[model samples]
Target: MTNIGGAFRRNINRIGADNLSLILALVILVFLITVVSGWAGYDGGDKFFSWQNLMNSVAQAIVIVGLLAIGETVVIVAGGLDISVGSVASIGSVVAASVLVGVGTFGSTLLPTGNVVVAVLAGIIAGMVAGAINGFIVTVLRVNPIIATLGTLAAFAGIAFLLAPDGKPIGVVTQPDFTWLARHRLFTDVGIPDLNGSAWTGIPVLTVIFVIVTIIIHILMAYTDFGRAIYAIGGNEVAARLAGISLTRIRIGMYMISGGVAGLAGVLLTARTTSGNPINGVGLELQAITAVFLGGAATTGGKGTIIGTFLAVILVGVLNNGMNLLGFNTFVQRVALGLLLIGAVAISQWRQVREEKVRARALALQS
Candidate 1:
């Protein structure tokens, strides 16, 4: 019994007590919203609660900021930041689309393995190359992450614009399977009844992709040495460097990861919209920042989680969908979102302070 009790305690320790309250708060909020909305005759079926609407919401949330959050989580945890994620996303899609169109009607038998593979690879390569440039500019020029990424943000955006010379979408990308990835339902084969007399059944394919990608990323960040290094670097760059960690390589890796993921998001967005424009991801950086911050990553660095990000993403989705359903104007919605973000941050800071105080008191008593 003692052994079993100790084992249970150890498991509890691994989970950490800090985030339990956040989870509780999330549950309470969700419950309160559901009950209140139901009482008020909300019928969020068309608003945010429907499978289609929820999937659409999740897709929009993930595709625009998902990659950026994954990348920023690494970058910020590594004690750096990049403002060029949006640009990378824009460039990535443009490159992929350009490659697809350039492949012509013999798309399936192209120089590469297949058109799908080529398109994905094109985006990945464009993003990685752009990331490398950002890293070089940061490490070589010794520029601040903000400034360096800002300059590259403009330059990369320009290059993406150039690649999209016609300023119009290209390719026969409307193929059902390809289009279904971002715009179609997941269980049409399962035969779910459709509301609104519309044929949009079950879950959106984008939501499934987001879930799969998020799970993979969650594992990667939690179970790898590279992931640990990212957190250490962000927590204390000087200490991390003094500990014999490779500051240059890790720094570069963070940016590259950021760029690569942003590129991935671009592809998903393009698939959803059937467009591959240079200006596609405009203001996306802001949304990504919002997601990162909302996900519980400290603006000052050294704290984050995949779960936190998931909750935050869903929170934003809920807020957006709810407000739209409530018929709130754009200005009001923005104001509410801003206030919500600020409040969450303030709560985090307050909790951090309280925990520090508790630790200090315990130490003092022990002494």
Candidate 2:
């Protein structure tokens, strides 16, 4: 019995203080949402989680923001940050919409077939190109990651505006029926029915995409040699370099990965909106950063997990949904999110300090 109890405690410690905090936050938030959701007149069920509205809203936001958070995770794990990702996504949407609809200066009929697959690829490539530019600026010119990405954020958005300088959002009106990309579902109903005896059907297509992306990234970050290199670089650049790790290549590659993933997020965003609004991704960087931080990723880098970020995404989604359902002001939600980030950072720092002290104490005893 003691062995089992000790193992459990050890496992909990291994989860890290920041991660444990997130788990606690998630549990508390869910409880509050469930209890107070009734104040908002939600009638779907006793618990807020039982409400379809809450679930759907969370699902939608998670799919959109989760991908962006994943990209942020990759960058942070490698000791960098990319604020321009939101802009990359914005530009990607613009590029894909323009090409698919054959509108603006690009001319219609570029994809006369309105081929969604082609449009998606175009959007993704646009995002990647933007990311590559960020990588070059930071890795080659040695600009700070934050500064480099911030510059690109403005630049990318400006270019996106140029793509549709008319200031009107590009819709799929002329594009070949690509709306289904966002609308399609998979394994909709393996034969489950609701309490009302209605058939429960397909999960949203984007949700599936989010899951697949999360699983793939989790594997990459947790298992691969590349993942180890990323951690080494983030944890101790000098030692990693001495160990033969190419700092420049790794840094550049990480930014590229960040940008590319952000681009893919843009394609997904385009599908969701069915239009390319240049401003669609505005402020998304903060949201993604907040989620990553809340998920236990340190701003200083070298520590985080895909599962942690994924949970953070869901947590954010639930918070947003619950707040909206409760009729809280939008600014209140923003403030709350900001506070969460601050708290997460504070907790992380505290943990670091505590660990250092523990190490020092052990060394003192040995001496």
Candidate 3:
């Protein structure tokens, strides 16, 4: 028992207390959701716990938010914030759809695949440009991150509406190739006997993309000098500058990355809805920011993990899915998420205080 206890402590220290807490909360929430689902007559919780739902429903549903969270993680880690990502996504979707409809028509007679590539490029580029503008305002113009992004949020959203005809959804149903990202699945013929002996359609392309992006971001943040610079800047801008880290360049790059990812999410959104609805990503920035904070990213910046953010995204997805199954209204769901955000921020502030106290005590002892 002593040995086991020691091993557990070691593991906890390695994984971090914040991450462990998130895991425990996720497990408890799952159990509660299952019990509630059973009581609600959802076939003993199968509605929320089934394999099909996990893979097809929940995984697919979280892709957009997950992507946004990943980008937000980078920005937050670099000592900045971007509340304009959703608006950037909206802009990307509109741009992608418009390009698809226009170029797709012309390319249909020539190179069929060319239009899809062009449309995707246009969307991503639009997002990156929007991000650059945000970075410029914050770094060059000396605007606060919150105010700068908030301004862009409104501006970009309006731009999206203006780009769309009559301020409405641009239908992309006719562009089947463009929507393939949302519809395609791998291994449709693989039968899993353990899963009701049915052929598993494998994972959705969108989910696969999300996983890939997560892995890439994780590597970028964990194993690169660029990532370390970001951490240094977030932890202490003055110290980092003295250490010769270019705050302006790194922060701008981080914002561009965020915008690029948000743009990709926008493209995926267009694929999923088969339309470029200017309002599609209206409130998604809130969810993404929530996930970043809830995943243990410091509100003051300088600390976070891609893995934690990914897990947090899953937790949010599960919570939303379970609530929907239980017939909770959207308004109630929004309130719950708002509460979660508040709790996450509070926890982050507490952690920061504790760390500061520990450091102070150590410095005093050394003196």
Off by over 4 Å in 2: 6-20, 36-47, 105-113, 173-177, 195-201
Task: Please write out the lDDT profile of model 3 over residues 231-275, one tens digit for every residue.
Answer: 999999999999999888988888998999999999999999999
Model 1: per-residue lDDT, tens digit, 77-195?
56677889888998887777666656322223333523666786778778988998999889878999989988988988888776775555554365445455576665667766664
Q: lDDT for model 2, on a 0 to 1 scale?
A: 0.79
State the C-alpha lDDT per candidate: 0.71, 0.79, 0.88
* Top TM-score hit: 3
Candidate topping lDDT: 3
**Cα distance off (Å), candidate 2, residue 148:** 1.2
lDDT of 1 at 48: 46
| Model 3 stretches with alpha carbons more than 4 Å out | 1-10, 36-44, 103-114, 194-199
In what order do the candidates fall by lDDT, top score first? 3, 2, 1
Error of model 1, residue 300, in angstroms: 2.5
Which residue pairs collide in model 2, if any? 102-108, 114-176, 188-201, 188-202
Q: Candidate 2 on 1-367: residue-level lDDT in tens?
A: 9999999999988886556777888889877776655675664334354324543566767887898999889888777988988888888788778877778655364454366777778787777778778888988899999888889889998888888749678887444356666777667657655634434545777888889989998888889877888999888889999999988887777776777778778877777787888987888898898888788776677888888999889888888877776778899999998897787778767766877899999999999
